[model samples]
Target: MKSNYFFRSIHAMRGLASFAVLISHSLTLYPFFEFRAAAAGVDIFFVISGIVMCLAIEEDTSKLDFIKKRIIRVVPLYWIATGLSVAYIYARYPHMSHSWDWIIRSFLFLPQQPGVDMPILYTGWSLNYEMFFYLILFLSLFIFKNAPIAAACIVAMIASFSAVGNLISYNYFFKQIFIEFSLGILIGYFLKFGGRVEKNLGIFLIFLALVIFFIHNKFASSGFLAWGVPSAMLILGAISFENSELFKRNFVKIFGDASYSLYLVHPLVIWGIEWYVLPEHRGILQVAIAIAISIFISIIFYKWVEKPLMRFLSKNL
Candidate 1:
């Protein structure tokens, strides 16, 4: 392992995690099965964001540049998706006035509801956490030059804000999900400094993740634990195979590259099916169709919309 060595595992896991989130929502929409573990995909994503932000900062990107790139990466497609969500909302509920609080706040990445409820385009809530995390990291860049130290400071900052945020917004922004990001930051630190684990250890980590996932699902609480620890374990395991080209498939790479699109667009596709094509139908067929359609459309959106926009923007920047 080397500091600058790119990990295919990161890309591969993005694909997997995005699919898991898609499946989780699909399941939620259809009510076909009980697979709360799929929700851990959000944890997986948080960890990935942590690692990405860490690596970006460590590579000597300016604080302003870091935030700029992050905004460019996240904001464009999100706004498009939000616009679509607004249309979906109005179409669904013609009674809702145009000056709704949730609509405005969703664009600003504020909480759409009082406590723990997601925004329109439901999966967009995760982006709120992501934007805040980037802000924290951007601020940290002014103080701690060390990536790991800055990451640690981010954890503390999140904890501090979470403690105070509970009084007013009751937002998840200051909650246990940061643990996954911290875990990823620690992992990113280790890898950045040339850390590696044995294959057997990687396997063990995944096994342990499963155990923890089951235990958490069955008994453990949210906040401090929930899915954070296990998702970290799973990611740590995946990256262990980074040097082996295990995640190097073209198909896999596309999924990873297109993950953001997959995440934002799938909810629309799924609910669209529920609203028109598969209304009141509770079956796995709808789930399959939703996933397939989501993946297909996301790839197209990535290639045509997201990739081109980012390229043009980055080139100009």
Candidate 2:
């Protein structure tokens, strides 16, 4: 039950999630409303990261290798994006200044300052949580060989501590988002190791979650359960086609490979367009232009910069 290679469905899910986030950001200029809920993509990503860590441990991976790969996968691109974000902020607000300490902490994947949500790169806020989760998984490697029990324990601890330590200073930065990762791990545990996941049940969860999303989209909810649990269900249903030929199509080619690039590149592209190209004319057309250019640039950066850097570091290290 615990054996399988790469799942195209998972990769495809990454592509879809990243695209959803990109769309959400592009809707920033809309006057009537903002598509902030598309940020459920981040929740989706959190769950995905948890599942990935679970998969890594199940593969009998070395803990050091797991950590090393995560660092390599995350750090270089994040640093570059941080540098770009700093430049963008300086240009956009010539008088506004970022704290040097915050910049350093951002690069280190540390939590944001009290009551602050975003980092230098804005989107890099999630990376802070990602790094923290990786730290847990790496340490958990010493004790738990299986992903399920470890995931259960993590979920319980987060729930218990959150209830008791709601006033803790750190909670300002940490919040309750940790549950998304735990949800993902539980899904991974159930699908990969524990037993069969019925297709009908997956379908029902997907439909029920969509209803929740639709309602939340109109009224807007604030809790992780509103977003995170739905995201987990989406992944649960999506990965049901993991072994199928669905994601291998040329047009649907796995943008999952470029997903990180998309995540880091789209905001810069969107902001640049808003600043330089069309400040006054904010409409659907403007969003179209931004998304087109962003995807193009992200692919280019992925091919020329990120891929080469990763390849070089993988070989050298």
Off by over 4 Å in 1: 1-3, 113-116, 160-172, 218-221, 277-279
Per-residue alpha-carbon lDDT of candidate 1 for residues 74-159, written as tens digits (9 for 90 to 100): 99899999999899888987986765677788888986666538777688878887887777777878877675567666675665
Native-to-model Cα distance after best TM-score fit, residue 168 in candidate 2, in Å? 1.7
Taken over the whole model, the C-alpha lDDT of each candidate is 0.80, 0.77
Judged by whole-model lDDT over C-alpha atoms, candidate 1 comes out at 0.80
Q: Give the number of colliding residue pairs in candidate 1.
A: 0
- Best by lDDT, which number? 1
Model 2 steric clash total = 0
